[model samples]
Target: MEQKQFFTEKPRILIVDDELGPRESLRMILKPYYEVYTAKDGISALEAIKKNPIDLVTLDLRMPGMPGEEVLKHIKNFDPTIEVIIITGYGTLQSAVEAIKYKVFDYILKPFNVSDILSVVKKCIGRRYVSGEIKNVLEKTKRDTKSHSEIYEQITHFLNQLNESCYYFFRRENYLEFVRVLATTLESKDPYTVGHSERVCHYSSLIAEGLGLSPDEKEKLQISAYLHDIGKIGISDIYISKDGPLDENEWAIVREHPIKGIKIISPLGLSSEVIEGIKYHHERFDGKGYPEGLSGKNIPLFARIIAIADAYDALTIGRPYKSPLSKNEALLEIKKCAGSQFDEELVEVFIEEIKKNDREINQMH
Candidate 1:
């Protein structure tokens, strides 16, 4: 099988404008970072796109012939993945509205600031790179029955390339959005697990609040919770949505998810704490978990907290293989496993928070 190359070269960019000054300015600004191309007219721009692999385009709306709107439509029809940002000197509400209809990445007024242009371009390219990689990985997994090791290798390579190319330009908000997108994609694989990550995040946040964690620590924990199950994306949908108990071999494959999850996000420049939380969430308090078997406080605090949240949701939410337990039943199960599968102190904190939430819900009702 041919392995997909992940942004090993500078992304190709096309600048379209009739005015030489604005077109050349854009070319100069982006030339240092990208494989820049330029066109003086819409006809030339269309030809350039057809001939080259253009990742993005900056087009002036007020061009002489072949108006920018017509060019935008052609670009989208040819390759919807190619991001286009509209640059217009004669900005108008109708034109802006029309740009939105065509799904332009951004609309910038002419005489744009140098920093603003660079920032917008970086953000657009960063999004394109990440989204493209994710699509590639997903398509590969769906088409091939590759082994878990092969899948891991593919993900690792893709992430390394993505980090090298785009991490420097990705903003924190963009990273968070990507995490949410990944989490949602993972959940979509199994109908029974819809909203699983968000619920885990909510539960983990409650635990964090009960323990009086600092703001930064809480935020890290939330990101960890959202991404904790990301590795499951590599797992076969047959196993994920299996209606019967997994045999030993199947169980072993399923257990590799945490490590897979780690490999998926480790290169995205998240904090070590967040990565560790995802890696160790399955670890047992008595040192008997798969992957790594650190016992008691040996597990990171975020991991322990997430483990509790994860297990709670699993117990309360019905799955194909087992019926979900009631709230009290799930609480009892958690209490029973405190010393062996969870942290004792954190368990207490989580239970109190659950009861507090119940009280609030009842009061409102």
Candidate 2:
């Protein structure tokens, strides 16, 4: 008795070809150790992929409407993990070279035997799975490295801004430069929030320093503050800066910014403390906020501090649909909302801090 050879488990192979003969023939040869899926052309192959998971693809080089090369490009574009083995009845060196560039697992000529086909299929699938993992790791590493580079850019920008004479004009000029870059990139989606971030930074820094935060703490607070509204870029501008109050549908988009900002900044490997400051700045001392609403001391200390600062800046700054409040008026509004909307302790600190700088308040143009 002969022993039967099999794969570790049945691998799914999608056979894409115009003709039925090759598809069925290939299925018959590999069906013992593989679950076969057949697609008549590129469209069908794509549809099958969305409907079911396909591990490997045996693609014919020529087909009606969409050719193998075009199909291969789409497959790689959609999901590069799936290995594609290009098969051509009319094989040539040019075809092989083209296939190589497309990163096809293997290329086989016509009149191939069952053993020959299986040998290539096994090799292709093995290479595909391993290479897929390697590709994924490389991509993730690239992203991490890219994010580190961004942080490096942000830090460099900060250092340069700190040294610049203009930096003395505002604490967040450098940080706002970075945030503004993100804003411009996402301007098509949300211009209002870009300005909103700038406002938050301007206000948060004044409040942070007013509360006598250490220079280091002030820097972190300002960065977090400027970026607090950074998450709004993920939301559509139409929904974010709506001329009228946002409807429930648009409001959902407004609420997703914190999570989105976290995801955006997570790759930078920033300290969790800074992330939390941005995450919970919207919470109220009286327990009414979106995303997460923790009142009183339950919220992080820096977050509570920012809530007052953020609101102060927001009220003082003019919006697309509203007029800016006067400095003293804004102060009174802050005082009005102190115990309810903001942390009372931080509010008193902020008020005292700003009151001393009457000249600065008058010049906050």
Scanning candidate 2 in windows of ten residues, the lowest lDDT window is 162-171
What does candidate 2 score in Cα RMSD to the true structure?
Answer: 20.6
Error of 1 at 329 (Å): 2.3
Highest lDDT against the true fold, candidate: 1
Query: Global lDDT of each model?
Result: 0.84, 0.68
Q: In lDDT terms, how accurate is model 1? A: 0.84
Q: Which numbered prediction scores highest in TM-score against the true structure?
A: 1
lDDT of 1 by residue, 1-365 (tens): 01114457888999998988998988898888788999999999999999999999998887788988899999999999899998876546459557976768887777878888987887787667666766778569657956755665676677677665454545564565456555765475478888999899999999999999998888889999999988887787678779999999999989998998987787777899999999999999999986888888989999999999999999999789889999999999999999989999999999999999999999977
